[model samples]
Target chain A: MEAPERLGEVVQASTDRFTAQCYRLYGAPPLGSLVRAGEREPHVYGIVSSVTTSSLDPTRPVVARGASEPTEEAIYRSNPQLERLLRTDFEAMTVGHTQDGTIHQYLAPLPPHIHAFVFRCTPDEVRAFTQRLDFLPLLVGARTPPGDEVLAACLREAASAHDQPTEFLVQAGRKLALLLGGEMQRLNTILRRLPL
Target chain B: MTGREESPEVLGPQLLGVVVGGSLSQGLEVRLEDGGVVEELKVGTFVTIRGERHRFFGMVTDLGLASADPRLPSALPDTTNPAIVRILSGTSAYATMQVTPSLVVGGEETSLLLEGPQPARSIPFHFSRAYRASQEDVQAVFGAEDERHIWIGSPLDMEDTRVCLDLAEFVKRSNGVFGKSGTGKSFLTRILLAGILQRDVAVNLVFDMHSEYGWEGGSEEGHAVKGLKQLFGSRVAVFSLDEESSRRRGLSPDYLVRIGYDQIEPQDIETLAEMLNLTQNAAQATYKLASRHGQQWLREFLALEGREELAALADQLGEHQQTIESLRRRLDRLNRMAFLVERSPEDSVRRILEYLDRGTHVVLEFGRYGSDLSAYLLVANLLTRRIHDSYVRRKEQSLGDRAKEPRPLVITIEEAHRFLNPQVAGLTIFGTIAREMRKYNVTLLVVDQRPSGIDEEVLSQVGTRITCLLDNERDIEAVLTGASGARELRQVLARLEPKQQALIFGHALPMPVVVRTREYGPRTYAEFGFREQAELAREAEKDLKDLFG
Candidate 1:
């Protein structure tokens, strides 16, 4: 089951199974974090490919950083009004959605419904999706897709959420070792960043 | 360093970088690890990626330092800010390598380094761990042995490890030793011959073209490198064409190779023409004269003293008068070589065959005659023709007599390109033997520096090629033609040390290997059965004492 907190709402849907639009809430999901949406049995699942925050007003420019701030979290806390001015959005590559209950790693038979309720996938959902690591190749590509950081963040979250954190990491590492035998740099980066 | 070999903590070479990029045709891209704690892999060094059920074998073809952003210079950035320096130092910047997978060996048996199809996927694993191949991995793949296997050289990475070559397969067809001059061609040939001789697999007949295969040959520093005769005395009978030169070198040559001038045929004279600087018409004159006067043509032609008689024969034969004179003048020089006698001496070809039939190796030393091109060509061609013809006949005779198996013979010739060059190959008997001498129980161990000059037909027929450094493009291509994985090995071949390294591949070896050739002096004698020979001699002495004392 997905978490009750709505991570985002599908703002725009596409006939292209690869892409979708989401209006992010106060907390945007981490890159590569598995998410669920769509109002029907064939709910759409995706990995976040990118995340960005922008000013809602067309004429104003927004800046998140300033001097004399102890930390990013402190700035956010001190300026709650900043959130109203700026809205968060994210892009998800629809790797595979679920029909009834089985996970998949291919494009949906049909486009995801518009304005579907999108939410963060629970730890169990993430584990089930990663059962065989079939999604790994879908996320990685040759043309420097900025896939490393996304993969690392997802792996760290998934490993920490598993029953045996270190063992899960080792298992994933072994799978990645075989899957990325020739892609050492990408592999090492993902491996070194495992939460275990 | 502390982990057991089988343990997860196994101490082997570690990764330097991620394989973030590259295509199949261009090659794979790998970033090196941050530091250089591991052994720096050379261009030809082999590395392996451990997949779930398979191990991928790859050769490192190129190494370079690279940056993620092309605009960024690779040099460490010069900056005063400590924070910037710290961040820059930890950046994803380091050495990178281009790796080419030549083989992907994996199966339940795990021993076979199979030349199978490349894996379906370009990358076997998402992030496979790489380690330098272990000794067991190498041995299982390369050191698989059988009775016919002979250890030729050690692998470049594995010290004191012997790499075995399948000799039975190697001797079944012709083979060659090719390299640039001074690249240990002779030394490698000597080791190969030693394997053949010590195994008693075949009898060898070496045409010592430079007088180098018999008692002694010059080393790179001009010191004497011991030759075949010194290494295996009684087993190898060393014969010389020039008796005085042999004696001058203080060698007791087993036989003085003598051929009656009457034995020289029209074809023999034609082969000698290149050395004699004779025109085609002059060479044809010898044939015309031979047909006119039969076996006594040389003597009769020499006996013709008057120009009136020469003019009469020239008119009668429709020959140019000057061509006839030039033929006679060139033919006259043959009398000056000491080895060509007009009359009685032992039949040299018969003697050589008898020795070979008895399974004794023969190295025919040209001695001073080796430098005289005309004499060497005439004698080598005539003798090789006779031996090859007799072997063919003997093979025919033994077709039904399994008990009387014709001894397998391997004829060793230097400057093989001279006899096997395309221009002369059709007429040269050595080329015939090179092309098709297998079923007759004969083969050639052709030693030459210029393999490119050898006839393509003959080169194509050569079974195995053990080449030293060859900078010539054609020679390298000729040696590597039809060899498996030769394209990847070209990088390896180019980097061989000019002295004692050789790249051995083809019919005999399981795979292409670049090895440091075995040292020839004491190490060679020790490893190649000198101790076994001594034990046999001691046992014979004991048996004699037990019978009589």
Candidate 2:
């Protein structure tokens, strides 16, 4: 397997989630992509739940300068300082963690440390983590807006990592059915997003 | 996934479900596996539950659908989507069934093979896996066909496996074959009769009301089906009450039974009171005349020529003239019966006894008189009373010598309610035989459609009941009156097909089983040593040529 692609560094952390700053101004991973943050063993795994790009300083508000430029690239070329001033960060909800090379589909005892390198998991890692689908209920129970969409996106991404992606999604859908049995409307909304 | 647990390993390919709840009396509840299609599980199919240490045999009595959440039904999610249907079927919503455990085979494997199955007194533990009963399991429960056991048919949905009845035990007590008219009661009765005759378990004296058991009876498709006489040849003797009707049907019976008027006792008249619609005064007047005129009462009474002579005789016997007139009116119905004669040259009862003594089964076809219940009631009552008396005498004399005991006799009667109903059950000889005949070496094989009309006591005493489709609620209740797990068996009995299938339970079977009754055709005939009609005709032709030569 190829080396895991480096994505960001964790800048903020909590028991269930962490915020990571990307290497470039707009280098955040796509929503629902799985990422691990750690330099050694016991890497905390999470799914990208949200993303944002803003000035590094909370009090600073940068003004638009592209009105007179022929395209957006010209404004960037004229203002090279803008890339250094702005930062891209993504929030990931912790779904599980790896311990002694075994992926446990549950919360890690401790959150990722500040500035821990975050890496986009390889297809093999996603396949290994989604093998059991025991972590589905955690995504379903996540306290976030568009939780259903994030869960569906995560499943779609995991499905692509398996030999029989449709079969894997069907199995995951069955687990979600048990989790959301009483909420048929919600379950239907999530299942409709799953690709054939 | 928060509370998920590993699924148990299914022990066999036929694994159906796992036991969840229930009791020994109410049956067990099983939640079907996710891979199982609820449509494939049918009620009345046999199942085996593998418990911690025992294997419990059961039948699927009921099936239903359940949802994990109560609001699923009202929400009514779109079921047209395949994904939604697939996910919700076994997890969010699932199928459950009720299994009534009937028999239990316990102990080590070797001991279980030796001891066989016993009645289940306990329920399987929770989560015990249940599977469709394999052929070997069913074979172990219902023993293989042999001399003492007769293969009746296969259990429901198991065409290759067999369900045998222990005929040796079946003949020890009176049994019943019940179904509504045209439900193939006659065909099932024929099968049982053939089995009994083939095994020589007991000697049968069938009062064939429709002449269906003597010569050849018509099947539901209007084709000729062989009767006992045709199947067993010399081993079975056909007696006819209407010689003309028998000859018209191309049957030359071995004997033509004629009941002499002098042989008609007061009890016979009393037994016919219901069929003849005789009043209480008329019924009593028969005893009065019998006491006065002795054994020739019926003959002398029918000989009375005028109203004045009857009045004088009524006055002589100290009976009311109106009562005597009523008795004369009802007794006149018997005079129209052709089988009744002024004096029969030979005793039909002795002739039957002779045939029975020779170990030959006898079927007395009622012929044209079968439709007349009065004639049937009179003759059946009269002959059975004498037979019962003779059996009692012989059985009493053979007390210390078991070998001298008369061969067990199974007297088969159709429209059994007429002779064994509650009103006349205590008064009729058939009722006596059904109640306490085991000691006297006599039992009854009752064939009837309206079982509710039979005496409840007699119905309870029916050791084994092989019942076909019965639509009436009362009839169904009557057949399953005293059965254990009757509520479960009721569903099985009611759902039986209108033809060929029957639910047999009681002494003959260890547990209640629904059977697709064996086909009564050329194969069965050949099994019982019956030659084909064309072959028999050729043999007869050869016999004629030899005699002439």
Residue B509's lDDT in candidate 2: 93
Give the residue spans of candidate 2 off by over 4 A.
A61-78, A143-145, B1-12, B34-36, B106-111, B314-320, B532-549
Q: Which of the numbered candidates is closest to the native, going by highest TM-score?
A: 2
Off by over 4 Å in 1: A1-196, B1-9, B12-39, B49-53, B56-68, B72-105, B109-130, B144-147, B531-549
Judged by DockQ, which candidate is best? 2
CA shift of B355, model 2, Å: 1.4
Per-residue CA lDDT of model 2 for B1-549, tens digit only, reads: 222353545564477889999998889999887635578877789999989988899899988888877777776656887766776778788899899999986544565677789888778899998988888889989999899898888988799999999999999999999999888889888888999998998999999989988889998889988888878889999999999998898779999999899898888888888877788878888888888898889999988988999999989988888888888888888889988998989999999999998999999999889999988888888899999899999999899887779999999998999999998998899999999959899999999999999999999999999999999999999999899999999888888998989899999999999999888876678875688889989999999999996
Residue B204 error, candidate 1, Å: 0.7
User: What tens-digit string does per-residue lDDT give for candidate 1 at B98-209?
Assistant: 7665556664333444553233244445455555556665565465545667677777777766777777778889999989999999888877887888777788899987
Report how far off residue A25 is in candidate 1 (Å). Answer: 26
Which digits, one per residue and each the tens of the lDDT, describe model 2 over residues A1-196? 8889998899999998899999988898788889999978889999998899998998999788999999989999999999999999999999999899988889999999999999999999888887788788788998588788889889888888899977777788788888987787787778889875
